[model samples]
Target: MIIVTGATGALNGFTVEHLLQRIAPSDIGVSVRNPDRAQHLADQGVRVRQGSYDDPDALRHSFADAEQVLLVSSSDVTADVITQHRTAIDAAVEAGAQRILYTSALGTSFNSPYPPLAIHAATEQHLAESGVSWTALRNGFYGDLGDLLGPWQATGTIAKPADGPFSWIDRRDAGEAAAAILTNASSLDGPVNLTLPSPVTLTDFATHAAELSGHPVERIAVEDEEWIAGEVANGVPEAAARFTLTMFQATRSGHFAHPDPTLSRLLGRPPRTISDQLREQMVRTE
Candidate 1:
């Protein structure tokens, strides 16, 4: 069986949905913090295991019978995420999983300043040291702006301190890459940098959004304080408001690295273009 952690998340959900197309529903297993919440999977005859990265014992139980397990990284804060991933890696080894596929970011390098790369690099290191057969999908920015990849794109304008070129990728590539690693889980060796090679600037994206959506997108450069004010006005809570601002600020530098389209080669086709995905999502909203 192939086990998928974070099965219900946007990106993870797409990955599992695609996998279901290739594998019998019975052979798929989903891991979530709340199993009852994933009744959709349960009803589909897929096994649902209750677990979290924070709970090693539960993780061991989650991986007990699975030959290949995709360890989706935790979305916790940058400071705490590495430890959480390390704990999960330890359990996967103890459970003797035949292969482990991790969703990681392009690690700390000259390409970008996304701080999470340092953390993801550490997580990838842990997976490598775990001694299990492994593959790391170093995913880049997603296509949609509402998501982690290009929230800037969602508004059709990136409002941040970022002034360089950046790439946007579709989640379909990420899902396909996961399926590839899991399908050939046994033979897979190392990592795939899931990003596009050529990147576009935020201004480049703004012009496209204005042309496509016909929405007047004004790119406003705001200070940290001004940004937080806008987010709070937009419904961000007080306690977490700062952290939320920090996330975008990090991306102003970026956590999701530059586009590296390596995953597309394994997918046997090009990934979705940001504009195509954006148009569909907007139609639903309209």
Candidate 2:
């Protein structure tokens, strides 16, 4: 059996859905914090167990009878993320999982200006010393591009701190690729970059948005501190604004610029491009 953690999240939720299509429902189980929330999956014959990274005993029960376990990266800024991941890793190994898979970012470096990348680097190090075979899916940046693009349609301008190219990928594609890797687990080990074949800068995205909306969108670079203040003024918390500023710092440092063909090879087709993602977002709003 293959057990997946955080099946309630967008990324892992998609992974479980794809896994069901590829394997028997009896072969899949999900370890989520709230089993009631995943009752829908339970109805489909998937074993849903209550598991939290903070609770070692619960995680052990949830991860029981697992050949492979997918450990979804934690997103809680308030919690000790590395400790949480360590707990999960130890639990999975204690539960007798043969191999472990992790969702990691594309440019995960300890020296990265972005703090999250450093956290991922720390977790990867823990995985290596855990005495079990592991695979880290180095997924490209996946989230709402609207936050980066700003209110382009209303303002006719994409304004923010300067940024470099990013090989942005859709979450759906990343999830499907993860399922493919899990089913064919023996072929890949260590870090594997899962990203689109090309990279796009903020200016490039602005151009695509302009063409798709049939409106001219100008790209403007603002000072980092000024941008943070503007976001704070607009009701975004100062700490959150500063965190976003660090992402631009990482981007300009070329942390997210690399693109690889490995994702295409895994999917047997090219993954969705930034333009394709933007077009779909536009359609949803219309």
Candidate 3:
């Protein structure tokens, strides 16, 4: 059986559908934090296992008789995710699962300064030490950028704590890559740097959205200290948020950057452009 965690999320949801397209429904297992909310997937013929990442024993029980386990990483910063992910890894090992597929961010290395990247890097190391055959899908910035930016940008302005170029890929496309790896049982033995072929700044995206939506855009220069202070004032709790914007500033300083067509190559298509993703946002929000 093929097992997938975080089954209700966009990445996991899309992966589940893609897996069905590539294999029989009976071959799929989906792990949800709550089984009650999994009716849609259960109706689609996925065997839904009720378990959260915190319950490693239950996670192991779920992994029982599973051949491949797709462990989707959590985006939480409480270090709770660290505990959860380690538990799942240990459970998979105990269950003797043949292989593991991990979802991680792009460009993670041993020396990453970004807190999220650092945690994922440590998780990658932990997985590597477990001795199971594994595939690490190092994904890029997701196309959800516009959702994060649009409301603020559309209010007579566009702004980011960011000041440099960034490449982004659609979440669905990344999901397609993950599904491809599992169904074909292909080992992309990676740190696969998944991303769009081109990078652009939030400033550039604002300018383009201005042209498309006819809303003139403006950049509000909040210094790293000021911006972070504002976020704290505005109730940004995770230390990751401050660290995230710092990475953006680092982008201006020429760190935390890569522009590879590895993801496009995997899917035999080009990654979504900023404009393409913006249009998608327009459709989604409307």
Candidate 4:
């Protein structure tokens, strides 16, 4: 049996849906913290088990009789992130999983200023020592430029720190690529960077938004502190604003500029672009 963690959330939920289309539901299992949220999956004949990174025994039982396991990184952003991953890794080993797949972030490193990337880096290191064959899907940055460009909606001006291009892959593409990897578990091993083949800068995003909005939108470079203050003034929590600032700082340092084609190779098509993602979001909101 193949087990998937976090099957209730967006990324892993899409992964599970794609897996269901390609494989038999009886051959699949889901380990979720809240079974109520995933009753629909169980109703479809999948083995839904209650599991959590915080509870080791529950996690072990969740992976029982599994040959492969997909460990979606915890959505929690606190310092407990590393510990949570470690707990899951240990449980997977105890459950005798032959192969493990992890959802990791691109640009993750031990020294990364971004908390999530650093946590992913540490998790990758722990997985390396697990002795069970494993793969880390280093997914690209997600989120529309519209999120960062919210201020631009009213002012028609996009302002942010000068930064390099980011290979921003959509969450849907990332999920599909993950399902493909998990299905062909033995075909590849080690860390694979799942990113778009091209990177786009903030200026490119502004141009696309202008076309969609039918208005002129100008890009303006501002000091990082000023940008953070503006975001806070616009109702973003102060801590969240600071975290976004770190992402931009990392981007300006070329952390997210790399474009890898592994995701395209796996999906057999080019991944979605920033413009396409933004357009889809606009339609959804409308």
> lDDT of candidate 1 vs native?
0.72
lDDT by residue (tens digit), candidate 1, 116-149: 5677778778878888888887776664466432
Measure candidate 2: CA RMSD. 1.0
lDDT of each: 0.72, 0.92, 0.77, 0.87
Q: Candidate 3 on 1-286: residue-level lDDT in tens?
A: 8999888888988899889898988899987888887789889888988766788878887777789999999855565777778888889889889888899887676565455677788889888888988878888777456434746445756545756666667888888888888877457774777777877777767777777677787756567777677667877865745766756765675444678777888788886677887876767777
RMSD of 1: 3.8
What RMSD value applies to candidate 3? 2.4
Q: Write the per-residue lDDT of candidate 2 for residues 189-230, one digit (tens) a residue.
A: 999999878888889988888888889989999998889889
Better-scoring candidate (lDDT), 3 or 4:
4
- Candidate that beats the other on lDDT, 1 or 3, i.e. the better one: 3
Q: In model 3, which residue pairs have backbone atoms overlapping below 3 Å?
A: none
Q: Which runs in model 4 stand beyond 4 Å of their true positions?
A: none
Backbone clash pairs for candidate 4 read none
CA RMSD, predictions in order? 3.8, 1.0, 2.4, 1.6
Model 3, 35: alpha-carbon shift in Å? Answer: 1.2
Taking the tens digit of each residue's C-alpha lDDT, what string does model 4 give over 142-254?
Answer: 75556766657678987887677777888889889888987883557888998879777889988988998899989898898887788789898989988878887888778
Regions more than 4 Å wrong, model 1: 107-113, 143-158, 185-187, 215-259
Best by lDDT: 2
The candidate maximizing TM-score is: 2
What TM-score quantifies how close candidate 1 is to the native fold? Answer: 0.81
Error of 3 at 172 (Å): 1.0
Q: Candidate 2 versus the native: TM-score?
A: 0.98
